[model samples]
Target: MRLLHHSTSTDRPFHLDPAPLVRWVYVGRFSIATAIFVAAVLVWQDALTDTGKLLVASLAFAATLAVTAVSVVYSEFYGRALGPTFHYLQSVFDLFLVTAVVHVTGASSSQFAALYILVIATSSLLLPVGGGLLVAALGNVLYVADALWSVETPFTATVWVQLAVFAAVALGSAWLSAKLREAGKGTEAVLAHVRLQAADILYNIRSGIITVDATGRLLYANPMAEQLLGLDLDPYVGRPVLEALRRIAPELVDAVDRSMRDRVRTARAEGVISAIGRRFPIGVTTTYTEGDGRNTDRTTTAIFQDISDQKRIETLRLRAERLEGVAELSASLAHEIKNPLASIRSACEQLSRSTFTGADERTLTHLVMRESDRLSRLLTEFLDFARVRVARREPIDVAELAAGAVRLALAHPDRPADVSVVCEAPHGEFIVEGDDDLLHRALFNLLLNAVQVSSEGGEVRVEVEDASVKQLDVGPNFADGGVALSVVDTGPGIAPEIRDRLFDPFFTTKPGGSGLGLAVVHRATDVHRGHVFLDTGPTGTRFTIVLPRAARTMPRFTLGTSSATVLT
Candidate 1:
């Protein structure tokens, strides 16, 4: 059988494969009626004239055959007309054919005349007022013509009464037809509005949408699909769903197809898609459903969303976690090694003080003591590196803190005479809220790192400027607000590769370095809800520490001179 084409104007077209069972019912009824009419003519042959009986038999046979052929043809061909208008035309033809059969038999007191009323009522459900009226007029004229010319019976009061009933049925059917047409128009308007709204929503959404039929043919693809898949939306309709998935990633096609075939209602996959030769992470969610009400089989829809930034953040978070673990380990080892280092230094100091007569003896003692002191200093740095805990918080004058650290560095007996500590700040002291001890340690570590890198006698500039503390822009946690203190050194700059992981634990360029100094500094800053940034260039590295500023009216705590001493 040929496939029927539906009219596009209807919101929903009626299309179904014709059922032979239904067709047989109508054919059987018509055949029984034809047989009955033929037997009736034979039985009345003696009572009626030959010519009259022959005419009756011929008309009965012709009406039976004509009705059967028309009914079968219409059931097969016209039922597929989708629009209300075409369906109305089909109903009209059906009514006209049924009325013609009624007219073929004698019209006066014809039992089959009632069939016209049934036809008109059924037609009213599908046809417009104009078509209904036209069909009714034609039926009425045929009824009148048959009544006037038929010889089988004379017009009776019953015939007149039936005609009145037929007229009333036609008029009422036409009015009902007009009402149905109006309702159909209203429904179309509502459906059209809904479709437009849905289109707009799909077009503007951030995620891409793709809908495919049971056969895996793409039915609809929105603008976002075009953007995410790097494919043209218009040309993709009716294409295989796998084709679009291939544009995103070949793996995606296989995943979706497998899920759909397995009747998976919901599934998600994350993968990278190459666009312009660069791979970007994308997340896809596929949803499957059988068509509504009809159980027309399953259809799958996939929504694509770009998640490259999210993946990058996840990677950074993992790296940060690993660094944290390393920081903890380094802190523990440093604590374990510090005690023995102090003992070695004391022993070497005692040896250096012992009496020695020759110049060579004095030089050898000096070298041994100097090297031991250096080892002691290295042990001290290791201890500092291993201790990454944040101290109790209090209000602190950053300038005074810097001054105190500089004083301690200057008072060292082995300090180079050429090294100078220069402090630049406005008249008002910049105050921040943090653990005083932790802040002090952080500042000292920064200064020491600066001093280590700088040439002997080189100037290490310390600037205390008011800087607002804010949250990290691209991290899991962010600080509220704080102050910043910068210690800039005129020393060899850090290399680029090391700069990325500068604050990472156990990442140090110095020989015998435990790499916990900056890590501790980072942890301290974090506990204070602050941030630390390193700016390195050809000139030197500048470590900027930002801590939340203390309220001006808050009470301050003072640590005595002995209390302020650094832990050995």
Candidate 2:
């Protein structure tokens, strides 16, 4: 059956699917038929004993069964191929069924004639706008003819009143069903828009999201989930994913299991996962919902994100607070001991050169003076660490400063024999707002250390560049736009055990070393509102100084000919 070719003001074809209404109608028809058949056979067997009437009743039952079966088969296989034709056919079947009931039970006087009202109301819902009216007209004709054919020539008042009631119901039912169909169309449009909006949000959210059914079968996993987990999760959908989840993150597995088995909800919980050979922490939350209050029909959802960078920033903040305390103490202690230490060194030197001193005495005095000098030198380095300050703030070209430091470090006496050096800096000025002296000293210390650590004939690289957001992820949070000056060395890497203590004052492994080189570098960077990062392992070590940029910059100064001075 086909729907009427119709359109709205927009010229778009408009039709409502009547399949749902048809199903409800079938259920109601079956119930009424069952009740009538049972009453005739058991409750009113004597009244229903006429041979011909019994045959009609038997035939009606079979026909009702046949029509319902055919409708079910057609609905499943043919679908909407016949459209309103199917609706019209069902309306006609119900009309005949109702007419037979009225005829067998004494025409217009039978209360079963009211079944015509149900048929008319249901037809209005299942048929298109005007199809309802068309069906009502035919029903009215059939009812009037049945009443007149089964009775005497004179028309009765009861029959006339019944016909008037039928007409009124047909008009009212058609009008009411038309309004309901319009409301249904508007509701479907709103629901479709909501579904699309929710789908967009679920797919594009930053955090990973996953859903699983009560049977532990995976239902949905967003794109971010696969990206964060570094796994092909799509293949596991509709299959059990606990095994895969357990391998990458056992903590998440426990959360989902608890939700599915015990209806537990995990909120603001933390877990750890290792992906791409790097271990990082993840924050997780899990919630489960039961379908229709069923214990077995549960669904669990888990949301999680990798929080490695967040954790690092927190650690850095705590570490900075501790180091600030140490710096204050270092400055005070250095000031208190400096004058007395100077007097002791002077007294030893005077005794060593006195005429009355014996040869052995002179040797001992000289040794004392030399030892004092060495102590004095170490103290001077401590003062440098304590005195890390920005003497002048300017938009200095860091590329120029790094190139100069690389040159001075290459010529230093401490550099390993035949060790080569490479310096990479962008053309023109790469500027940051900081004291030239402090930044230069920090850059020089890193370069000197790198060159000193290199094996004979190994390479040391000095690189300078503008820091981007990606690089700043591991740096201090205070730095916005910045410059990165890095010194890399090819040599035996630092031991993992002592890596944490590398910046601690007097923490050293080298003989006759002050251990204040990195501490000085750290202090200098910290004072400039920047940070230093040390990457060291079995391969080698790299020290990077990330200094925040000035409020503005320009290609104003070129290297080698400007008033800018590089300090070591």
Candidate 3:
């Protein structure tokens, strides 16, 4: 591959150094010099030894070596200190060397005469336009002068043919060089544009991408990678960053290392990242590319993304499926048992009212009826969870709902007297389109749960936020505009082992808990195309309900028909 150097000077906005190619030219020149001297000594030794032609050949060989040594040192070590003139000098030196070879072998009939064409073509590519033709004319003069001055040299048509060939080759190669140079500039422009586009895409994407070479040098890290990993990666670029990467995202570093070691690609793999004491799931993918023999380096690229929302959505989807099936079965069982339960209660009541009833018989019948009443209440909760749906799409003010729910939840008999509830709704009206009754019930359930879990004198805060107006880390699932209702409590948080089952029907932690509250919350939000998020730790538990798309106007509670009570 050819490397380009950008020039800043207006006199030469661009410069292409032919030093690499020139080095190759030196090799070819040395090989030709060696072959010519060897043939003169081994093949034509006696014929020219006494005539002094062999001595001339020896001097020519010595001059070739001396000129080449100086050219290599000047071009390679000095590094374009003399600019294009340095290249011009090399081309002229090559022409003179070829002329000496033509003189020693045979002036007009020399087989080594074609060496002049080689020098002409090399100078055409190495120098600017007209440089090749300039060298070509000088070579013709040297060749003709040698032929005229030599005693044994014969003037022939071959001399004229050789000169014509040199001129034609010079013109054709120079034109080709000019075209190639123009194409290179156009290609460089296109490459620069493509590089900008790729960089923009990498930095702006939601996922994190990192590229690392086999020796642990960080090749690239995009902006999202820096944010997700919670580190400033710009300074570590083109340097070893594996030590820094290991603290927060060791899994990501390992993925790249495995790819580099195995020379393979991994797709849709699982990884984890932690920052600021919060660890979350991330989906990882990795791939490796082996460098060409010219460069001994292998690169591995790792791409990962925070998948908390995806995992939450998947869990909710699975829980919904399980609850729906359970709800249907519960409804069927309740319907079949309700009829017989009522008959049994009726028979026990009738038996108690008869004259034959003793005190023991009346007590048993009362106990039977009370137990039946409790089971009936439990069945009703099951039906409510199963039948959750958005009965009306009306713009109901959520801030009003939260205030009402907070008041009622705080007043419940289950709440401790000293435990306080604070409702904070920032905007005047945070409106969402859903069944007002369902939204209210779900909001109340979350608040009541928080209140119940709080210690005496602890705080339970209910906040209503318009996510469109606020920047919140609600994950990608709820990235769109929403009205987020958060119920936070200062209680011992829910356990990780039980978090997955928090929304399952009849799953509870209390002594006499009927665990359909969170189930109803999940089902209600699902029907409204919203999401319910649960974040619990040792400090406290936070339950967030995000209802997608807050409404612009209230359809059910219009100002003309009725005055909407934003707060009471």
Candidate 4:
């Protein structure tokens, strides 16, 4: 019975019990008991010589076997149909069978007389308190009747004393069995409640959980697991998990199975799962285990967790690492080339200072000058791309910085005569925490780019808007609170292919352009922890810059001082 109950608890494969295995155990026990009775009858034939003994022995044996067989049949095929009331009646029948066996064997002295108490005790363990007590009471009544009927003479003192003792023992056993059964029930109830609470907790958790057996059968799956797999729970259980997996993701099954067979306690794999026509990154982790020594043949448990967000973060981290390496290489190359370029520029200046005689000499000098200027421009662009140094940040008025950039842009040799610079902002100055020179340079580049892109007589609108910090969706690390400076142009818009790689070094669309203007802007934005965005369409190109605001107590950098050279 104990083994049967244990098997029912742990080994049953289906979700619900459509057939009760307990009935088969009862039937086998009934057959053994019938065989014992038959053997007893054959061995004790002499003792059953009298008519009373013959009738009692034959009737008791037949009655006990009949009751046991009936119990097994009803419990197996008709238990659910019988309902609670009929089930309780079956306990009554078992009590009657035990009483008849005690009466036939000898009311008080027979060894089998104690069998009635055993039956009652067993009944108490199997049934609820009301049913157990009903059987116990029935056994007590039968014991009293058997004792009274076995008396040879009426009202003997010794006979009465024996009857009284037997009755007391029967009652005592019944009460003890009932009390023990209640205690056992209480303990089971507490354990069941705890298990239910644990199941609830697992279901409500946000992290995905899937537990599979050694046979590749999914034994347990939580709500999160269902959502992650996009499976409905009702139809998922008891199905070959691998077959179901092929419908969702086939790659996972092979990896998970391999990990389990190799006794791999933990391993991680990543892939993409298609959901609603879109691909989502999925991370799978498997854990394996053999059962405890007591249940060595039991199934293994593997828990899976989803880590898509973590995978995305790691991917971004690797990309940033690559970008850093490229920046370092560019900086190294720029540094190596700048020293020689400086010497060449110095030698050209010396040649210009010397005497020139004819047209050919003048033309040679002019060529040297133009080539030197080109070399200088190339060196500047390379330095901007390298951007090796950290920012020496301080507080500066954004409006004043914008004014300085405008002055520098207008002073250029190729400045358009019809181009106009306009600033639309609040009267009170807005301060930003950044390197003034880098900010000036970035703004100057953007203004120069805007001027070059705009047509003659076109207005270059420069607007500084102060509001709560908002992030533009296009760039990495773009989220922060800051003031936005927009330089809007009226000219031919940027091409689609060029917009994607605008900040890339040495990429340009203009004929004689160095192609470092936007790249330099990007580096300066990085230094200040700000962001730059370009929106180009059929109308024109709009360049927007965002910078973090500085607190009032910080000292501010203004024009025309030793610090002013730093902003030049």
Arranged by lDDT, best first: 3, 2, 1, 4
Model 2 off-target regions past 4 Å?
1-27, 43-49, 62-93, 134-138, 141-164, 181-196, 216-221, 229-250, 272-281, 295-298, 314-568
- Listed in order, each prediction's TM-score against the native is 0.48, 0.45, 0.47, 0.46
> For candidate 3, lDDT tens digit of each residue in 118-168?
888888887777777898889888888888877887777888999999999
TM-score of 4: 0.46
TM-score of 1: 0.48
Tens-digit lDDT track of model 1 for 1-568: 0001212244553222224434654565466457646655666555256565456556656766775677567666765423445445544544444544454455566677887676566545445566566666666666666777767767677667776777788789777756666676777767667766766787799987877776666777777777877766565466565765676576456546755665666656666677666778777777878666332356777787888888889889978986987677667556645665665566566667776557756666666666566666766766665565665666788889988888876676545677777777666647776678888888888888887787776878777765521212222122122345778888878776777677666677888676768877887776676677676777777788766555442122222121110110
The whole-model lDDT of each prediction reads 0.63, 0.72, 0.74, 0.61
Q: What is the lDDT of residue 392 in candidate 3?
A: 83
lDDT of 4: 0.61
* lDDT tens readout by residue for model 2, 1-568: 0011212322223356666777887887777666666666767666466655456556667788999988888886665454778778888888887776676666777788788877877777667658887887778877887788775333568777777777787788778777876776676666656755766787798888888877777778888888778888867877878888888887777767755665554334567887777777887778878788653367888999888888899789878976886786576556545655776666666676665558756665666676677677877887788788888887788878877887888788898769988899867557787888888888887788778778878999988876644444443232224676878899898887887777766667778777778778878888786777667778778777777666434222212221211121
Candidate 1 clashing pairs, residues 3+ apart or interchain: 331-386, 418-457, 469-482, 482-547, 482-548, 483-547
After TM-score superposition, what is the CA distance of residue 93 in candidate 1 from its true location, in Å? 3.7
Which residue pairs clash in candidate 3? none
Flag the better candidate by lDDT, 3 or 4.
Answer: 3
- Over 1-568, each residue of candidate 4 has an lDDT whose tens digit, in order, gives 0011122222222221213533543554465456446645676676456556656556656766776667667765554443445545655665565555655566655566565555555555455545556666677677667767777423345435544554555456557656765565666666666766766777687756665566656666777766776876545454447677656765466556655655555555554555556556565666667676332333434344455677778879978986995886577556645765676666567667666557756666676676677777777768766763446867788888887777777787666889876767767657777788878888888888888778889878777765222232222222122566778889888777667778766667888777777778877876676767666788777787766655332222222111100010
- Which regions of candidate 1 deviate over 4 angstroms? 1-80, 83-89, 103-106, 180-192, 233-236, 275-278, 292-297, 332-568
Give candidate 1's error at residue 16 in angstroms.
17
The candidate that wins on TM-score is 1
Task: Score candidate 3 by TM-score against the native.
Answer: 0.47
Candidate of highest lDDT = 3
Q: Which candidate would rank higher by TM-score, 1 or 3?
A: 1
TM-score preference between candidates 3 and 4, better one: 3
C-alpha-based local distance difference test score of model 1 = 0.63
